[model samples]
Target: MMILSWRRRRGGHRTSKPAFVEDNPGMDLAIPTHFLCPISLDLMKDPVTLSTGITYDRESIEKWIEAGNEICPVTNQVLENFDQIPNHAIRRMIQDWCVENCARGMERIPTPRIPVAPRDVLEICSKIMTATQRGDHKKCMELVEKIKRWGRESERNKKCIIENGSGCVLSALFESFSSISIQEHEYLLGETLSLLIWMFPLGSEGQSKLGTAPSLRCMAWFLKERNISSCQNVILVLKELFSSDEKHVNAFAEIEGVEEDLVKIVKEQTCPKSTKASLMVIFHLISSSTSSEKTISIFLELGLVSLVLEILAGPERSMSEKALRILDSICNWEQGIKKASDNALTMPVLVKKILRVSNLATDFSVSAILKLCKSQEGGDHQQVEALQLGGFHKLLVLLQVGCGEKTKEKVTELLKLLNQQRGRLDCFDSSMDFKYLKRPSL
Candidate 1:
């Protein structure tokens, strides 16, 4: 299976062919690629397109038009709108090549059409990171297997070099340790955050060798320790990270050292369960700072959403409230509101989730969202609807019935804001609030 991950634009955008593909076949392909498809001669996968802009499924595309499409196989430029299919001769040639290369073909051909050296292999792995950061999962999978192979070999070599004392070979691995640490000190966060897309399953091994795997949380600490608070870059990284991986829905996900840090912060007794400080760390990195997609995606990809939901669902009211605020933070990251628009997430669900979280919130906790919903004075209807969907009436009831001055204050603020949209309340008995409701219309 060809894992051809790529970053498509917001809509119908195409990425340029990777530079590795044009150089030598070895760098772009793990196995012999030349014999696969003569044109691009690379791995072929989903949405198999033709010169005429027609897309076929993997099997159908394989059956009808082997050797893949003649044009750039990555985007299916030829089949963009499907005016026509490729010439029969071209399809036949590709079909013949597929038959020859099929794992169960009649003739077993060994040795790749192209031979790959370690350098070429390394280059390919780096490109996988690039593709992943750009939200290109299809392209990332193209080299996954080869990436695993490289890791296994690199692992073996790292052990060998450490044991043999080959001129302190680790130091010469790349120009990084000093630079990596210096980069840490300078507080220069990543703009792309795409590295995390490749760090999964196989891409992380190269951190010691390729310098591609970036430590986002650790880097955040490094920045925080230095008071380097420019957050625009970190947020970009987080958004890109969320755009790629869906693994961040849990609290104790095992992601290198960073996961350990988050867990440590969450579990500490001395630390506020609300995790005000740590939340400040991640929130600053993701919502305020600029980072690569890898960092941004870590929030979404590493079970961060589910984790947030769980935290908001926890028994500790303040902590739960903080978690909901964090969810809102994730939603509000760089162009994140637009992200929610593009993804198929429902506003009602988010509201219901907010209500679920709010039900357990402390006096001031639930009010945070009321303040947020009222931010910018009702210019955004989606936010208002989210609060209402989360059972805004029930929340107001909770605030009303609860016998606390803080609760009253929050309700007062809520009513102040609600008055803006109160005109939509025509069905209500205008005296409803003045009657059975707690604290009486004020």
Candidate 2:
């Protein structure tokens, strides 16, 4: 409505203006051309001029530069330098424009403070390095907190922290604290772990260093801490480390009580993120080549089957997917099959999820069901249970929708297994009779 009123100004003559588009693409407002940032095509909140003679919103341009783009977004020319001069005149113009239209629900953008520079990040990292080496816990944590603030400030600040190799310093700080007892430095460990995970997908060097037994052991100990944030960060870092190198899996397997803590995180459902991370960690541990047997044994002893069944029965999608994958992975063993089959929900839940959740879920569910059926000595009872639960129908739907070759193969074998049972011959007649006999008997 304000835009319509603005269009009728100056003796009822409409002023041709460039329309604002980015934030609200559908609304074509009479926004001044000079008020917009070329990159975002939106009103510039903090206009800054680049050396390439182009002015853009500071946040947008900083993100572009930090993303390693050498050419300007507007100019498309090679950047000789990365200096952004504040466009004070343009900023003032935008502010005045907003002020003129303040009665129309237009809000003014606040002035942005000076951004953190690479030199600033490097200086703080230097202080961290020195403080860490000097064994100054107070100053070290203070500096680490400062770095964390900078990192949380913006993506540009995070890039600066990473580009300046803060990971090197942070990992060193972690190792230094690892040798110390967590009980004495719980706060320090929480802060360091949070920051380390913040700058995740650590460089190869950092990964190799942190993936060591001692580093992992220290992290595992941190898992037992009562701090929820610390547990989330430690599990996330562990996920990253395990993802980077499979050897960490075996190393983690050797750590006592680590699996218990991970299972507890899932059982208690501390947070959705931590639960998913915990499940991922377990999946990786089970996927390990050399230590998988021991890992499976430990997880089974910890009641993982029941826990996974509980997760699957919940309404969460991603967690259920991860839990199903874990179940399928573990089903290769007879003990895994026995544990899964012993649970009442295993067949019913797996059958319910077959064609219901997702393709991956269906694949896993089908695989687990096939394993359970085959694991039985008579196989008749399990097949009958599967057929009674409509596994046969779900598998047909799965085949129609299509699945992977392996999953298709598994489904085919499972269909044959269900079909060989006593109910298969009369399935069609039984279904028809049930439908026709829907009327209540008097």
Question: What is candidate 1's CA lDDT for residue 84?
Answer: 30
lDDT of each: 0.41, 0.78
Question: Lowest summed-lDDT stretch of 10 residues in model 2?
Answer: 433-442
Q: How does each model score on TM-score?
A: 0.28, 0.79
Highest lDDT, which number?
2
Q: Against the correct fold, how does model 2 do in TM-score?
A: 0.79
lDDT of 2 by residue, 200-282 (tens): 77788778767776678888887886478888998899888888788778877888888889998999997988889999999
For model 1, the stretches where C-alpha displacement exceeds 4 angstroms are: 1-284, 287-294, 301-303, 331-334, 338-417, 420-442
lDDT tens string, model 1, 187-216? 212211222222322222332322223344
Which pairs clash inside model 2? none
